[model samples]
Target: MEGILIFAPFFLIPYIMAHIFNRVNYSNRWMTYIFSGIVNLAYSVLFDFISSYLKEDKSQPVCHFPLFLFPIFFSPFLILLQFMFNKAIIKSVKYKRNDSQNEQ
Candidate 1:
């Protein structure tokens, strides 16, 4: 769908933000996932507004901010991403633990 175009840039923005802003000590995965989603939603809206101007739409709507609601529309994918991030972190921690144990 053409609507998918507006969300293209957002797919990665939130995931990257989740990593960069991720708190290693925090046990609340939900908080991290939701916070990152919110941040990316804001970024996606801004990107949509800015990109809409770049688009050659002669009949462009006055407000393209709604285009950035992809996260809301694709919440299942967001949850999947959260699962992946958590799994990866768990794997990394386990790997580190194994390595330390081996070193001793």
Candidate 2:
């Protein structure tokens, strides 16, 4: 339960962003990938900054470049998930349209 709470944002944020993109009808593959990467990078930096600030070690550097790289390294996988999510949303919308059409 506690662990899920910690990790939930990592998954949820991308999914929510994908949904918003879909809602706005922005389906460009490269754009989606780049946007998700930037969002994840910002999130990683902010989280690290807060955690480090709360720690007692004022001597340690707050910005860890390697930690920032994780988002870039895993962006392909994240983009793949976003693609799938977008496809699923599209399919659902199509299904609803078809249902309404058949009723009419």
The candidate that achieves the highest TM-score relative to the unseen native structure: 2
lDDT (tens digit, per residue) of candidate 1 on 24-96? 5446555757776776677677667667677887595667646655667776777677667666653333332
Best by lDDT: 2
Which pairs, if any, clash in model 1? Answer: none
TM-score (all chains, Cα) for each model: 0.57, 0.64
Candidate 2 lDDT, tens digit per residue, 11-101?
Answer: 7766776677665644353465567778788877776666667889888666667657767777777777777766665333333245766
lDDT of 2 at 7: 49
Among all windows of 10 consecutive residues in model 1, the one with the lowest summed lDDT is 89-98
Tell me the deviation in Å of residue 96 in model 1.
16
Off by over 4 Å in 2: 1-7, 26-30, 59-63, 91-104
